[model samples]
Target: MGRKYLTLASALLLALCLNACGSRPGTVPPPSGGGEGEGSPLLTPASPDDCYWTAVRHESYNPSFDRTEVSTMPTEKWWADLYLNEDGTALFREVLGFGYASYLINVEWWLGADNVLRLTGEDYDGELVTMDGRMEKDRSVMLETPYGDRFYFEPAQKPDSGGALCIADLEGTWRMTGGEPGAGEKHMASLLNIERRWSDGEEGGYILRAEYYSARLLDTDTPQYETQKELLVEKREEALSDGFSGEPWSARLFSEESGAEYLAALTERNTLHLRRSDAPDGPQTVYTRSDSFLPETLTLTLADEPDDALIFYWRDPPAEVAQPLEALPMTALEKGGQNRILLVGRWYETDIQFCTGSAEQNADGTLGEWITDTVLYEGTLGIDEPQWFSLSIPEKNARLCLFMKRPWDESWFTWPITDQDPFLVSGNTFLTET
Candidate 1:
């Protein structure tokens, strides 16, 4: 009976060894060329140096409300490129397209002896996420995340010998346009000029000079150039990651006097987007390639003013008499200043009631009124007319209106008068000061 038990145990051990030697359904075996064997091509300690260019592709899946219902198609796709070196270090660059915008990520990678590739750096947002993947056959690598997502990387074509971008491309001059108030407005017109110069021996670094000018609105005269600010930016192409879709380049601009750092990205072949890196969501200024040289002198010109007819004014005194009490010029409407409205006209015999308000013209050419602080000034011509009445404007770009009461009796008549309309006039008639 003891012999029988020993034999049974030996049989069970044999069965276990056979099971371990057999391949699993979907499991990938280690490459025979790298592991210890008679004709192994790779050294005992694998080196990823020869894997020059690697392209990565990944797919992500999202489960539905009923966890069991996962769509067959992947929800999103990501692509990356990697350049590995002999020192076990690699440069990785990835492009993620989320919604309407595309974001870039650059990180450093390290390869370990056990065919383990580890990502060991953070992105621009200061978020650090590490990933581990296994290298396969010196030609490909497969990374599987804890969430079951897999990323596959294969050898890719080498980039052109000539660099994708050079400092000379950014050298010379660039013109920057587009900002808040827009062109030809009353606000100060922004004139931005950027100049780049290369150092004597360096091929990639640049000495960037930026000039900001605030000129009078729509003025060509030289006096309108009010303020000029200058900044010297140190420009270099950061090797944050391997070149994927395009070269990844960034410029770090610092003011020696202020020690403030500004971030600028080469967003396109000939375009740049710059902003304070600390304030990611803040306003970003765009600079485009320009052949024009920086102007040594700036001129100012009179900005175009809103039409005079659009300006609304109640006839002063609300009297039947036709004489001006005071001139309500457009310049009087300072950003938040107030101006009085006096009803004056020969047709003001009937009791004239006027209120100052705002309206928006629709695309169909119809006006929609947006009333704020409605104050009615009612008085009979030459009788109850107030000595003084005023209309307060909130903003320089505000559109104001003078609304008159509809004629109740047919005897009340005036030029351009209609029963259906009660509007005397409305528009952005106020002159804006720079």
Candidate 2:
């Protein structure tokens, strides 16, 4: 994420910095040279290098239950991206809050007599921001800094050229196959998803999202305490996995909200190892590739207008995520009986809730509707097994039962209705209240 750590002057900047960026202060070797920055050294890199760092707190939306999942990444609270040119001139930048505010400076850097590294940069406003630090014992981290935050460097190399793993290679959902022994019987699994996403700001690239509990949370044995991270990742070689050979296509796994860093590498073609750098042999998590989880879509398009609607069928049931979509068209209809949008999906339920009503305005300037008497109001929920259920809408039709449904999808629009929540009926008597 080009997002940085800002916090220049006021509470506004503080709020911005807190939101825009954050860091995780662990001992993962900074991505530089091939691995540790110690040799080519963050203290002095002979060649120009690139790094992306973040200090962060974030949330992911779960549309199924209309919930917001909040998380504090267990990561360094402060970090910066550094570009050290051969000429001794370097650029330093940190984003705060949401990339809305930033602290970017150009400076001349050098190592001090006591082996301390120092940097002096002048921000755009002409304020000189000075930074100094000493290499920690492992030389894998820079511990003392102006921000009291440790720093690590990352390799800016892109695998696109090295004939190594490409950006497209990482897309899909991967779940850690097993849990640490004694963890629990909950079948605990960590998830890492890489999806190619496009947006005006990011144009088109890859978005990496990961879910893992923090050390503090894990210490409490609450594997359920989840910390989800969404990071903007590109061709970065964080470090070579302990037992893996060659540079593995990797992403920086820094959890600023959780204060831990896991160096994930492709241990094998479909196998991934999320090994902690400090404890190379420590209990690590491994993942196996899987298909991206796509909820079954049920589209309801207007019989005439371009207005379209969608109702998703989550197989995992209460599937904890909601893919965003445009507002469903409730006003795309007249008082006609046959002007229905089709009701369908790789429908798990043969009797999906089908509601229809004459489009009209309410007293509150909003629109609402009642269940219609149209010959299609049968609804059903599901399990993956092929089972049958009686269809009961418009009186009861025990003969109309759901078959073992499969091949989830629909063809044409038929049932015209505005998308609404599940309706309630008393005594199986259709409500005639308008």
Candidate 3:
């Protein structure tokens, strides 16, 4: 009986070993070339002294939804290629499509360890391409600038979404309203309402888009306009979510009577005009200059007196702060009359590198930690608007940090600039106990 039990235990041990030896289905064994599995080539660790070269190409395509024929490059595949590529001394580029394929485009290039070259242009098929073998570097790659130099080919984490630079150019508030003129009336109220949406590229330029909302009246006390108003409201809400089916601009424009190209041209800023479809002698009207609705710019301010208070600034101030309130260092203020508190340093969230996986392994790839959703007005004040934050000061002595928030991002993060003293106020100055 003892021998029989021993035999059973041995058999179980053998079975277990065999199961361990068997390969699981769908699991690819590490590749022979030395990379562990088919992991992204871009993430392969670099040699100690060697600088790597690679890039994430963000190709923007503003394609319409219904048009099934239109195609776009997947973001994950492009990102994978950047990490999986075997060679580092090469230019990496990617192109992607967004929206209804009507609005924006972006192109990014990496020049080795520290140099990065970017170019942007509009039009779906605009003439834009950059390729030259001479630009390649077989040895070390570096870019020299007046202030300092950077290793162009090195890898630094970037944000998840793709966005345009010079978003700051889109600065300013645009009171946008939509509608066409009646037969006798020169202008009509906009059917769509506008909401502000700020997009920060990486961590720098901030751009705001006033999302237009179209509303039709529901049942109301006004009998004559009730039915039509309800339908209009339904249509406007549809426009907000689904947008214009084939061509968003048509539904977005003044009237269906307008030409397609004409409406397309209006997409450019301050160039819209009311013109007839045919005869040259037809009466015409133009909407330009101040007549055009534009975006508004929020104001920014910093601290007063002793400069040690300013350490960092972040875009998208934290929600914890009550806007227009100052962040003061409590203990520092009580001692030596040194109210070492910082305020009013305008900061914008550019990017975040979220480290994930087991902290023990440290091998798990860094997920995209950067955000491009909203521009934050960060400092040490609890001001709702950045402009208001700058204009107000704290009544007491306390050290606080402020930040803005956006809809697209998950949690708040700070930029390197914000981590450093960007707004430190001290000395006998105007910003004193008052």
Candidate 4:
């Protein structure tokens, strides 16, 4: 096999792999989960029935030296699955992307006279690779390569596969079941845990939220801070026909963090494939029914105030500015007109409780609610990188709060009822940030 082809296949396929755990480098561990006993099995002829042979042992010897070496050391590759059909067709699925993707290469195979198994396939770079295996009593196939390389084969316990799947079939929790997403540049927020409920919050739509960044950030340059993403996945009305499988269901996933939607597809084999809607050909992640869940860490960074929070008064407060707004007691909230959202330490029109929970952890570990001077109701999110402390003003109403948008400007005019939350000057009232 060409080194370049192998490198490309390995990078793109396993890049999205999950649970990327390993023992040591340059050491090939025994294949797990599918095959039976391991290491140099007793010789037997290959079975006539169609089956997949999981590569158990990969060994090679160089003939250049005076003494040739066989299997000097098997390389540790996450996936090298070989599928043989009774009809003489084969598939060599190489998975290298740490479980991110799989590249299926077409192969042709035939059992010649005396049970000689011949096979041919191409790598990612279209480099041709040929190997011949001898079936001992038709029980096992031992493949031999040019460098005296050998691959011990055993039947893979293929999972039961069904035809088309409905939304109900995939409503349960899903887990990532590939090799861990190793610390590579491409390891961006791999799926850790997923729960797909077939309800639209009010019992009509769909909601799929999952834990992300399941793969630990071994690489120092891992981008982003939040480890989990709250996704709003809804099933699409249209159905898609997949030639590789059968009729499959389609869905769309929305993320508040990225403010971008993703497309999800499902078919047989209990697998859910997710890819970005904009970059269809870009990186994708796969998930299967949850078995043993992988553990994930959460890192929360609470800003001093909401990203849209601002303090602008008709008259600028003293330069030292102690307490821009008075701390209105819970009872004082009744003084506001129409009783809109209330702010504990901030100003509000009707004094409504916009949200609950501690703005920041108290010194005694108690909880206290507080916010900034005022919040700008940004029309839509994902406009500017939102800060947890910065107030969110919808993009449409952004112009209303134009003075506040200037982060560098030290002084600005206060829009009062026109720009603040529960806009008193608005044609339509806005909902409180949950």
Candidate 5:
């Protein structure tokens, strides 16, 4: 969930044309019903039964482990000594420029021991994440997995350098139950329902404000060259993967058929602001704490048994100069049976579309017009390190799309902030306390 390439000097080259199956070459015309849509506002007091839990399942657990023997065991760094203070084993050499290999992936699920939902840590890689998969709770129902992958624990008051301590409590209102950004590659899926407030001091500092609605699915399909000198050698390998192959992208490419609905306001703490229609002078995005975006904390020390999932720690970053993106091989996607909501990528404005589809729904609800296959992922995805992709949507209600096409220049130095990316998407909804 991180990618960067800016420090520009000079660049310009735009030429697109591809006609296949009679009219369907980068289509973008679907939003014509009325005029008032982003106005269902009202539900930010933080509400989700105020955080109630009773989901248990622990029949002597053993949900398949041996993924190559936990990939050669040994984990539990403990957030790199709670954010690396004493050099702490170099903490991956102080994060080697934040491209990302791993440093977090602890997601255990189960609720009903007086209600204790768990979320360990995240920050998979980096890309300034957030196309509405969900994140922005500093609390409603508990959430911390937007860019830094995932983190949410429910029973605190144990951190005296002891154990367990994660409480960001989601503020609420999220609905964008599916996705896939554009050309390159992005993922998404959302459905938050928070609204639990209670902040004063040590009850783990609570204050939620929930409200969700994000369906950011942009796609820019590529790969249709058979002539014109092989489409000019595939547009010079997509301009050397957008960074001029030498690593450079303080980019900008605009085109408007008139269609916008910005408003990504998280006011503080890694701030953000992009209000287009509900404008108060739109256009302002910020998020500072560099290392590409953020996510280099690794802390592991488990044995209490209930840690469930694991990958406890990781590291990579520092390793660039290999641009030219376009690799979709997981057997060209179409796995076994049902695990729906698959539209690999999308985002049209600054050019983005990796649209490939297969979303089924045929009843009275209406929504079955996605049988596509497009690819065009040239450059700038997750900066230097982090490179991991896995998808197995056996649909139990899912939607995952994360795309950010335009705007990047150190995000204008955190003007009210919100710069997140360090993604990790997991499922099978496991949480057994029986």
Candidate 6:
């Protein structure tokens, strides 16, 4: 039941190579009329007793290099899951992917006593593709297309009971929450709605619609836009093999638009965990079951005026011109029990300076000298993205200064500086007053 990863680019390359080689001898083709073929003693039809099987395919590429020569090398593998039912119906799930864009293709299959395996399925584009393969040693299935494309699959270990819950328990709407903390203001202000509807069938099929908004400016309280995607899913016990802990039942969701696969596990807390099959380390969002499917709007506003002590000055890279910006209030910090200043904004590598003493003002309204100035924090705001930061303040009413660095200039050491100036140079900075 362990999850397998594959790359799409490699899979495409393999398909191209197979097409160029031409069909091989001894490969079976599906009969024009669906029925039994001439029996083969050595390759009899797979018995219904051993109906469940898992298939896998793997591909890797490594370049061979020498002092004066270089060459490209490639390796390919194939796998699948074959399920034969007592009612004469068969199901075949083919795993495919490259990197984070991995998915499974479900196809209806049939095994002929003549050692031919017939597979018919609708691809992502809703086009039908039929193929046939010859069985080998009754333990392995080798499928091939008329274009000479071949895929091999061996028996896979059985999966454990996924959980106590069934697909019926997940047939409802859910509100999503709990992602990367301090990620950004937009992330904090956004909300997600997920609706699961079951289909009228014995296959325990369902459709999931995920609707989410991407807020451009958190301070404005308006979302930049909203996106909704539908995914097809089926209760899958094999999901337990991927080390998911929750109510035992699990499901696989396939997005036809992106051709990506996601594993969903419902926990006892009424939360559903979603993870992409290929990008295990990627962000995982938890969705809590909700009572209704109605969507909610999110609005953010400051509770009170920011204290003068909380004022900060920001300057873009090259540290040339200084701009004063107010921070957006965070509900988490407004509770007031914690002695930390939470700065939640989208920022690059930024330097923060705090003044231990109060700042004096001149007659012209310009700021005077600071009694004690110290760098409180200095580093990148987030990992690959702008995230929030919580800095412990020594005392209340301390002045804060911020300096954001622009992205590195790739052509700094080159001839012409082609790339546009870093985004931070726009003289805009995020800060909160409260």
Ten-residue region with minimum lDDT total, candidate 1? 294-303
- Whose lDDT is greatest here? 6
- Please report, in order, the local distance difference test score of every candidate based on alpha carbons: 0.40, 0.37, 0.25, 0.40, 0.22, 0.41
In candidate 4, what are the lDDT values of residues 236-304, reduced to their tens digit? 655333342423456666777677676666655367765567765555566675432321210111123
lDDT of 6 at 351: 32
TM-scores of the candidates in the order shown: 0.30, 0.30, 0.20, 0.29, 0.16, 0.31
Model 1 ranges off by over 4 Å: 1-78, 85-106, 144-148, 161-434
Segments in model 2 whose C-alpha atoms lie over 4 Å from true places: 1-164, 182-186, 198-223, 234-240, 245-249, 255-260, 276-279, 295-434
RMSD of each: 21.6, 20.8, 26.2, 21.3, 30.3, 18.8
Candidate with better lDDT, 3 vs 5: 3
Greater-lDDT candidate between 5 and 6: 6
TM-score of 2: 0.30
Error of 3 at 70 (Å): 26
Better of 1 and 3 by TM-score: 1
